[model samples]
Target: MTASDDEKKMLRASLQSMTGALESVKMSKANTKPRVCLYEVIATARDGLLRRTKLSSDIRKEEGHRRDLNHAVKDANVNVKCKQQLAFNNQDPAQQDAIANDVENAKEEVITKQLEADAQKERVSSLYLERDDFNNALSRMLDATSIVMPFVNLGEIDDDMLQVGITAQSTFMQFCEDWERR
Candidate 1:
């Protein structure tokens, strides 16, 4: 009876320890869930920042192109006016006809440049919409990160560290299961 009592006490103590350890593991898993979510939010923000950078560069280039085309249109219009004035002043019908032809060509160039500028304006408008979309997404992500940041400590939550921790937890649980079976 004395030996049996000692064995029972030892078994109860071991069982209590295992239960405590399991509870600790459950808490760790709960904590890890928020950490993983925060990490994903951060990763998405980084990707969005990169995309925004590229988009900003593209917008700047397109805006520059639009400006140049608009300037060309203005210059072409001025050229048409000058050719028309020359045609009016010239007394020679043949020379006036040639100048008139030049004036018409200059008008056509203005039309072409204006069309190009319009296309670029449309492109810039579309790019602005795309940029706005990214900004909105990033803003929402920032809001989420702020909300969860207080709850989750990201100090040791790097990708490799996170994976290793999860793996270790799984392995430890497996070991516990095997020991229990034994």
Candidate 2:
């Protein structure tokens, strides 16, 4: 299901505030000339923020897995005593035993929990890898925009200018994109 009405209202309010702030920035006068499209700047900034958030989320997931595994081990260790006690509850060996069965169940539970934690850890690592790639791509884009924007301020908007001369920003973006693919 979707979010509740209250949640939607809160989100809308937040969005409105963000829009107002961005509009203010757009209207502000600047000493430095903006050479690239404003959209490019906004997009690059947003991408940077997204990459950072993804990287942080990956780290949190990895830490969460570690905590989960620790909890599972603790629970199993405590359950060990219970299982042993339950297994030998009967007064005689003549009766069918259950302590062994309880212990086996505990073992299975520990194994299951550990496996789940391991899966989460692997997922976290995968996210981190993607995060790194995105970060590199954003950095390259930022560099390109920095160089292009200044040229644009100088009334040089043609693609031919970029072709005639190699800017560090453009080169860096190309290098980053290539590396990210690998």
Candidate 3:
């Protein structure tokens, strides 16, 4: 079966409404936008952490391997902090270059990963709603959240934003495990 034209129209209308709401949210705040500007937050957070970690790791690797494993871990932690503070800096958003390509690719990957992450989150959210999966959602959420955000503030963590991030992480993890896909 396929969606009827009415259903298609309704879907488009729903999307438009959400987009409008997003615009409102974006315009209402600046830095805050970076934090709470997501409905599918678990996926959003996974992408953010992935973005922070990947960038940090790449930079550290280029700077030269850490002297010891402990130092490497420390360096990795610091790098994530640095990335959290580092906003999309380059003035011209339109500008493109070799390094830009890497960042662009990373951003793209974040999208793909988040899509996977979101699918996972949706599964957990459904489980939580139905109460069928029992503690499955909670466990999945915790494991996934830990993978991205262990403890310690990367930078500025608002309570609400942090909570959302936690929920999102758990949801994503639950789905990943449930689907039996990496």
Q: What is the C-alpha lDDT of each candidate?
A: 0.74, 0.65, 0.51
Point to the candidate with the largest TM-score.
1
**Under the 3 Å rule for N, CA and C atoms, how many clashes does model 3 have?**
2
Q: Which residue pairs collide in model 1, if any?
A: none
Q: What's model 2's TM-score?
A: 0.54
Best by lDDT: 1
Q: Which of candidates 2 and 3 reaches a greater TM-score?
A: 2
Q: How close is candidate 3 to the true structure, as a TM-score?
A: 0.22
lDDT of 1 at 50: 79
Q: lDDT at 34 for candidate 2?
A: 36
Ranking by lDDT: 1, 2, 3
Candidate 3: residue pairs that collide: 42-168, 141-170
Question: Candidate 3 local accuracy as lDDT?
Answer: 0.51
Per-candidate clashes come to: 0, 3, 2
What's the best-to-worst order under TM-score? Answer: 1, 2, 3
As a whole number from 0 to 100, the lDDT of residue 73 in candidate 1 is 92
Residue-level lDDT tens digits of model 2 in 1-182: 89999999999999999999987776442312333333445464565676578678768868787787878877886897787776567666644255677788888887888787777777777777766776675666566666565666665456554432234344544654665576
